[model samples]
Target chain A: MNIKNSNIIVLVSSILLVVGFIISIVNTMVLVSPTEHIEGSWKEISWEYEKTESGNTNKKISDAIKTEICKELIIHEAEVWNFLAGGNLELTSNTNNETLSWTMKGRGNILELSHKTNKIEHYNIQILNNDKMVLYFSTDIQAKGIVKMTFEKIKEDSYAQKI
Target chain B: MLRKFSNSRTLKDNIQLGALSAFSAGMVNVTSLIIFFAFTSNVTGHYAILAEEISKGNWYQASVVFAWIFMFFIGNFISNIIIINFNHKNAYAAHSAPLIIEIICLLAVGYYGHFYYRETLSETEIMVGTMLFAMGIQNGLTASISNFSVKTTHLTGLTTDVGILTAMFTKKKYRQNKQLRSKFNVLLAIAAAYLAGGIVAGVIYYEAKFLVFFAVSAVIGFIILYEYYKLKVTKYIRIKRTIKLRKGILETT
Candidate 1:
């Protein structure tokens, strides 16, 4: 290539580099928000009720059932929270096999949860209420898909009821 | 136009240069998907999205992303064919043709991806893929032309070289000239452009979909054509210089 073409090559290459550079910056800043942090084990529960054509359950019934379910789940929230937050605690009743077993690090209201066994991602913990805490997974996929179960703190000595 | 300067190199050398950018493109493309459900030049991001959708029970969305990923691979394959088949027999022509194609493809993809096919591909995916492919093709073209003397597409490797060069410069042992200057400029440009591309994509992805890729395509097109135009100007200058030299010699005789 001549000096002219060489310069052209340089120019073209520079443009590509610049374009890539801009994209890298954009991905970091715009698309991804920094993961949130929290402390302790929290209770998280998600439920989806599809409107089935054959089912007679209407919106009002579903809403009332959901409310009652939340109310009933309130009692076990603290114990669930303790089990989740407490180190080295094993659950014989967690039959779902979805419980992520990972060594968690970080402190109150800002927990950084990670599991070496699961190569997926880290979890951000949040305390939603006195008896419920929330674990925010890396992507929104976790939020939209699965029903998360977590617990919130209630009192010191006496533990809340178990689910 | 042909006799201005002669630097002959083989196809293998060019492939090696293109490989640097292509590999980097793969990494960035995959990472972009990990961070955003987008495909960078690599199809892995789309795969991840497909997996995520399966997990989320969104079969429809998953299928769509899968189709988009398929298109990306098709685009890459087509580009490779064009580069191989339609390229120039001459060294310069061969190199220039690929770059031109890359430039054109990026522009088309950007426009189609942004405006016409807005709903088909997400904002982040287009940005990632376009940038990755553009870099890949740019590296391929430059490498072919310069015989692997230059690489501006990927900076991870270039940055390492720059570090070594900086050390060499600091040692004050080797003299630096236009060649070194060009290398330095390329290094800086790559770094700056990558940074800029990220920032631009981020902003556009927020404001609207497809706009980011559209903008990126325009930039790539301009750069490719600009280089060719610059080459023509250089040819003109060289011819003018030769004429002047001939006149001087004749007058003296």
Candidate 2:
């Protein structure tokens, strides 16, 4: 290819890349909100604790209290959290069911889930996409650590429903 | 290898450039994956993630992915800029500039990750971005200096080329084509070297962790030093031959 044509190709690709980047930023700022994206049924896939102690770190849920909490909150069969519209979150599992108030704070990075007994828990939104959400929160029960929970959105097959 | 102008480069030069750069790229990619859970040497998966994030309205993630892509693009742009602007004056300096930059980036990552990195999300993002930029420089330099014959940072295109060449070789005429065979060899060498580098990196990372970046830098450094050594050796041979001819003329006089 001629130099001029090659330059044009590079210019066009660069422009497209810059334009796409700007559009992504603008879209994030104006078109979508965390609350809107978080409103769905999601199943718990996995959870782990990132434990940091004296400059050494390991990611595992080893503390007894943390393990018990995981069992109570996540390990049951068919554990799912359904974030509904109008600021309500419904958590369901084989042994328990509860409804809570959910709100996104800190520009959609902090997810606040308020329980019925007025206990409020905050999870940092590590990742929140359409199909997956990863939430994390620090704990000091056993050691200075962070707990990360990964959830996958449970997609209901509308076509299969019709069938 | 020091000859910056693509047409002057030999097949051996192309092989050395392709194999070393591809190996370092592979090491960088795998090491980044192990540390940051992100691919650094290639943007194909990042592009897909960008599209996915945009489609899903995860604008934050979309922007992050876009920024990563932009860094890679900027690295390529900077590398080519250095080459096209200075290649006329000093081919070796111009070509080595990008690899030097890549080495610095890798070393910085290695140092910061080993001593200071806290495994935070921000740290991961920045480290991954730095790696992508370094790989971009490498990819740009190899492709530019080889007349676009060798691109080492990503194997998707190289793999496609190899596949096409292999299929073409089924024809008797294509089998006899020297250029096609040479191209196939370069691609295969690059692919094999990339895989081998990744395997070595994986094992090193298991024992040494972030110091794997140092090993990658050493590989790139070797490429530069090897070329310089060859240049010096050839100059010495020519000088020796000229001196011997002068001695012969003196005796004849």
Candidate 3:
């Protein structure tokens, strides 16, 4: 109602606005949608048995079994998974390159990958963020347990871009 | 189906409403699953996702899921409010309003996805949100009208009920109970219809894509129109009987 009161109100409101904007930016830096978090070149770090039923402590899975596990899977041991915009996924390894499509289901909890041949594979997204994405998939391989796949986000797509 | 109130609804009415609505729900769920990669008819998984997002500190996604959940809640609230407030005035109007809104929502999603869809995050989010709202309206209306006997949105409780009914039928007394048998028949019809709808939609989605929503809308439209036709026929029969009785009284006088 008074001039001084109005001026003080404006000053406080402007300060609040600035503070809110700063917090939003900071939060955005830390937060990302599943799509945004997944849209990059991710190199496969390791493949390990998530759990064993026979109490076998051999959690370490060799890369050889990867082919058997991925037998029905079109992504067979693809070392690098590059998720691009518009549902395009470029999978590559040391030997050859493959292309597929990807979509996130159930609030980004499920990563569904579809090959051009109409073969579909779903991977449960255990933990996904800026730097790391952990995935789990059921395997009927020799060790009948969940297979945990860990992947690290490639900051630069230079290596992936080559293929 | 739309004309009857809760206690007055017969077993036939309940089964008809349950089967058809469940079929449409299944179709919508599968279609949304294929297109948006989200389940629209069911909110249970969405609840889990909301919790996960909140726990993970992804405030944006948490808020998105929160909004989606809220849309569903608000849809149910609005459907129930319409029914409770207007049923005393006009049961048919009260029941039909939510379904009309549902049809509009589905059509909007279909139109947008068919024509203007860019498949962006925001677009997918909004489409899925609208679908969830549509499903909520449908679930609310069926449940409200049927006195909560015919909930067709999700199969979790329905499956549990079917399981319980099957277990009960193992006993001779429960097996002979007419009400239990009719309820079992209704539940089984709904489950079968839902699965059939899902399989049909899944089979057709690859070909029809967004156009399948038009088929869903048609199914809901058929329910509304069929009820209207039945209401008209019943009204006509009652009017004819009343006129004949008046004529007989006049002749006697």
Candidate 4:
């Protein structure tokens, strides 16, 4: 390896690194806009809470408690959230429906859902794509930890049929 | 240690490089696991996940895993490319360049995690990928410069080597082999250091959080600076010896 070759290699590595950094930033900007991808109806696919116990151990909550929590959150089986264009979010399940206002902040990563009583809930958007959205939030209630909720976009035809 | 290739590296050099890099690798691996729910140092589990995701037809997850693997691969590739191209002109510089990059990556992760990280999946994924690349660079440089004798990121191979050597030691002839003993020592040092690093990081993470990365970077920086200091000392001694010899000749003449 000569000096010239070494210089070239260093230059190339630096360029590649800069390019990679740029691409990563650009990809985040272009591929992850919550407002655009988050609109429309979404069905809850799964929800999980990871609790940190002693020794930094992580344990998932029991099924019964998980079910209760899900029920409390109005996210029972086949629960859906219809995110309308004008900041309206409609949460519906088999037996219940509720409407909430939603706004995104922090580069479309922080989702703030507001109720009529002026209560606001914030969820960090883990992932938001055309077909799926994963949101995460922390809770200090029973089995305190972070909760991750995954949702799949409900296709227009299926949503129409359900309506 | 800085300029010597693997065939020429002493047992001391091998142990020093292996242990320090392994320690940092362990810290990065454990810290990323604790914070991001991902492992950044090694790709074996990621490969398995990739396979599983592919089998399950989860393209998104499979692709993410694939990208992680690729980032690790590129880290190795870039490090080796730097080394092979520049080992002749300035072996130390060639070797240190990758560590510099690794340090930068770890620092970025640490700073962002401490101040700006929102604990989002995107943030986690990007940070993990950055760490994987950093680890790859480290693994590549150590292995390449040491003539493939040192791999600090993962212990599966080292553990296997140790197992084989231990089994061989059951024979008297193998016990008499100095090379085998040296290899065993290097492996043991790396394994112990890796475990120690992980334990330290785990304990410190409770208090320092992402600032643990700064500690890891300092460890790596010590490795590079120590070598540079050694190089300078060696050069200074050589200059002093040459001057003494010249003075002696002048007096005699």
C-alpha lDDT score of every prediction, in listed order: 0.45, 0.81, 0.85, 0.82
**Per-prediction TM-score, chain B alone:** 0.54, 0.97, 0.97, 0.98
Residue clash pairs of candidate 4: B6-B146
Best by DockQ: 3
lDDT (tens digit, per residue) of candidate 2 on B180-231: 9989888988999999999999999999999999999999999889888887
Give me the chain B TM-score of candidate 1.
Answer: 0.54
Per-residue lDDT tens digits for candidate 4, residues B1-253, read 5668879999999999999999999999999876766788888888787777568654545555666777898899999999989989999999999999999999999999999976455566678889999999999999998888999987889889999999999999999999999999999999999999999999999899999999999999999999999999999999999999999999999
TM-score of 1: 0.42
Better of 2 and 3 by lDDT: 3
lDDT of 1 by residue, A29-115 (tens): 453211211223333344333233334343222334444443432122122333343322222224322243323321111233233
TM agreement with the true structure for every prediction: 0.42, 0.69, 0.80, 0.68
* lDDT string, candidate 4, A1-163, tens digits: 9999999999998687666555545554555345767889998887677443332354555557666666645333437899998888888877778888877653344677777877667787767777989988876546667888889999999889977
Model 3 DockQ reads 0.18
Residue B232 error for model 3, in Å? 1.2
Per-residue lDDT value at B171 in model 4? 100
Chain A TM-score for each candidate, in the given order?
Answer: 0.30, 0.68, 0.76, 0.70
Report the lDDT of model 3 for residue B89.
98
Q: Assess each model's interface with DockQ, reporting 2 decimals per model.
A: 0.03, 0.13, 0.18, 0.08
Minimal lDDT window, size 10, model 1 chain A: A138-147
